[model samples]
Target: MADITGIPPQSIDPDQALWPNAGTIRSSNQTNAAGQAGNAEKPTANNKDGIYVKDRLEDKDVKPEKIIFSNKLEASTYLKLQQLATYGGENIQEILEAALTAYFVGKEEASRPLPPKVLAVLRKKYPFL
Candidate 1:
């Protein structure tokens, strides 16, 4: 194949390979003037996994960690959610959180203090309470 192409496949010396991050994905957040990421060669605790982006907290801009949650909803329900978001000029997350908060608050209003006897039994069963 090399002879047909008139080019030879030269072996690469690992130590002298330029652009160390040539094949790895890199974000715009971290890159040197040479377009190579700075810490690709070393595997630190943060870079141990495949994720190689800089820690946002290190930049003094902390954001709440978000966990992905998803469930199948009816097509109508999904469409309504999108329409509500657009109408309110808010994302579905904000709308859903607000709705859940209101629901919890409404449910909490129905709560009544435990009876003395029940409280006594609970206290006896669980001293911490």
Candidate 2:
């Protein structure tokens, strides 16, 4: 998956061209247009630059499986959330999940106390319902 470009085919030695059209290997004294000695580093599997296709593919595989979750919050609320995260030694996402879960649970418990018909009957029995 390595690719090298900008080399003329005829200049490559037959034995050194391990495969057809492999990149040129310059003699020690040869200089590129920049006048730098032709000591260009060869791309390798462990190179961090990802100049080769395989290196880029491997990088993709090694990346963390996380997605960006963006939202806007009031300044005060955002500050409170950040403080809670710092004090509790947990992340904002965890705190938000717990808070939302508790809120829904409270709503469910409130609903469990009475059906609408029963509440209406109670309201009729006591005007101050």
Q: Which candidate is the best by lDDT?
A: 1
RMSD of each: 13.4, 24.1
Q: Model 2 off-target regions past 4 Å? A: 1-68, 106-129
Tens-digit lDDT track of model 2 for 66-108: 3324689999998887656545545555577688678888476
* Superposition error at 108 for model 2 (Å): 7.2
**Per-residue lDDT of model 1, residues 32-124, tens digit only:** 324544544443355555543443235322233533356898999988886665455455666777877777785755477788998899777
TM-score of every candidate: 0.32, 0.29
Q: Which 10-residue span in candidate 1 carries the lowest summed lDDT?
A: 55-64
